[model samples]
Target: MGIGQSGSKFAISDLGFVSGGSKRRDLGLNQLILAEIGPIKGDIRRPVSCALIRLLQDPDVAVRLASCRSLCFLIGDCNVSEEDFNEFLPTCWSACFRLMEELQEFDSKVQILNLISVSMEHAGEKIVPFAKHLTDFFQKMWEESTGESLLQIQLLAALRNFVGSLGYQSPICYDMVLPILQKGIDINNPDELNLLEDSVLLWEATLAHAPSLVPQLLDFFPYLVAIMERSFDHLQVAISIIEDYIIFAGAEFLNRHASSLAKLLDGIIGNVSDKGLLSTLPIIDVLVQVLKF
Candidate 1:
């Protein structure tokens, strides 16, 4: 029996499977800890956590995933300190990045990403203190995993949540995002066929939650014109983006992109279906009202 400061008992025999166990046993132990050892006080909990963290590098992919899920719950509910949790982040981050590289199953990879998200949710604003580390990890993950569309999409969605959580501190990572955002929005790119839609959504997410539009972001306005020209596949999303630009960048946006914007609006009005027109017209009114045209 493993004993803790509060006289809590964790059966050591159960955790012995952690060192030489089948995937199923490892999975069982993880759930066992959360159910049984959740209130385990004192240093007794650390060895169980270490077992799970080491299992993160296990040969069995199932074990790795189960181990990660357990760690998230342990630090979230077990008597773990924020300082220890912060120290644990590097191990967790590296394990996740390695798993992302190794795991072929789509669902497994998503579980890994969502596990990070769950950690963020449990930690709440406490995560803000590690923005630099989090963004560094995000940049590396993106750089190391190019051309993997599903991974790219999942990571962007996760990163968008991070941006929203980071709130005012989000733009610290904009330098990493700018190129991806630019590449995703370029309708001419062959890969954009898969990435464009999510990329547009990410753009809107960034714009909506961002504290202020940096100059590079304002420059993204013309890409919306490009998107409008190709197709109104993202009509309402595109319209909403334009409204944000007009509201935020004001006269400078109009002066910089007026002619092309006018031409794009003219084509949109001429070509958009009645349904699409319903969405496009008000933004046009806003544009005219803003410019006093």
Candidate 2:
């Protein structure tokens, strides 16, 4: 009997054979059908998770990608309990990183990232313990790439989701994450707004979680100021970051930097035409709030 048929009992090891040959199409079909059957409960959940974990390492890229989708369905769509996912989390995590390292295809890496995003959503802060490992993975990826590639942009999005999941108290916070954010700011492409937006959101989340990082961000003050000269989208994010920094760092840090900030804002304001002023009012409000501190 086929694996998806009612009352059929198949060994998890059999999945290896099915995932190997031309029969792989059948395996994919089975996984989708099983996913649609609702959650795999009681006696079967562990073995099914283990089988999917093994399939994630399948030599066929298609199988690996399908396995990732199936895993998302099982974990997120099916509402698998956190405790159940924990049983196979290490194995699944290892497989994800391994695929990230070994896979040459961009789409495959994106599949892995999607799996991670969904997993983090379902697992919540329970996924925080793996933050360092993910940070190291992304750090390596960042060092190797030019940081403007589509893959890198997608990676930034994934990093934002990961950091947002872990919040500020995560062990990977300052040292590991700051460098990546710096690289993100280095990408000055007007077309890559998503990357910039995600980077800014991550920065805001970081400050919200640990306001102590505000001083560290002061080093980037000039860069953020420079960003205000970019397009409106870029300027908006820069203003948001500056507002967060002022609010979190308190009056003392602002006082120390006030002179330089005032000088920068003067130059920026002097350059703004009447039309620009209309759009820049929100930023001006933020500056007013900062000055009051």
Candidate 3:
């Protein structure tokens, strides 16, 4: 640890040297230096931290992405006590947020998300304090993502990780995820099966984390039922979601929306002859179970 009394200061000043070159190689080399120097404890690491944070916003995509990975390594490699890690948390998260906000490329976005996953893995409970900020950032990103299927998949995966890391009780658990799922269902096109599938998987993962959100599924019942009518594949996912809702929130929640639920079930039952009983029977069983309560 050559990170002496003035070592961080030297690192900060040396950042200017790294800033002079515009080539990706130069910026990547700078990131290498940062990863090697790593994060240290005490007030001395502040300037080095700030310098790395600034690198996260570099115009070059390589530099920005490399900076993200470097930060991950820095955090993971650092031998700091819990208290010191807590102090470093803000700087680390702020850089992540900045990188997330600024990066436009899908690959770069995925890399930043992976960096966040690594941070969460290393930091454990220390990552909890930034949960709201991370959730808000992800919500914004999800809203802004147009129809990029790959990006949506990555975003959904990232959101799942976020929810899993933060736990079911996290403020972002239900409320924030519900709207995003609704948006997916609203925009879903039959032709874009990948997007639809990702949306369904995301929904399933979110519900797995906070089953209480099952009641919110009532809001999308009509649309899902309509989707179910069009395609058996859609029907499978739609009914599967209903099944989860029944299992999690119990039949009481479905009973509250009994009329609507009945109609939806009726539609599926009515279509079974054309769509085949084999595909629709499981849904019928789940509905029958719900009706019993």
Cα RMSD (Å) between model 2 and the true structure? 5.3
RMSD of 3: 7.6
lDDT of each: 0.75, 0.66, 0.63
**Tens digit of per-residue lDDT, candidate 3, span 151-174:** 877777766667666665544545
TM-score for every candidate vs. truth?
0.71, 0.73, 0.60
- Candidate 3 displacement at residue 174 in angstroms: 4.1
Q: After the best TM-score superposition of candidate 2, give how far the Cα of residue 147 lies from its true spot, in angstroms.
A: 6.2
lDDT of 3 at 271: 64
**Mind giving the per-residue lDDT tens digits that candidate 2 earns over 163-190?**
6677665435567778777655655655
Number of the top-ranking candidate, with TM-score as the measure: 2
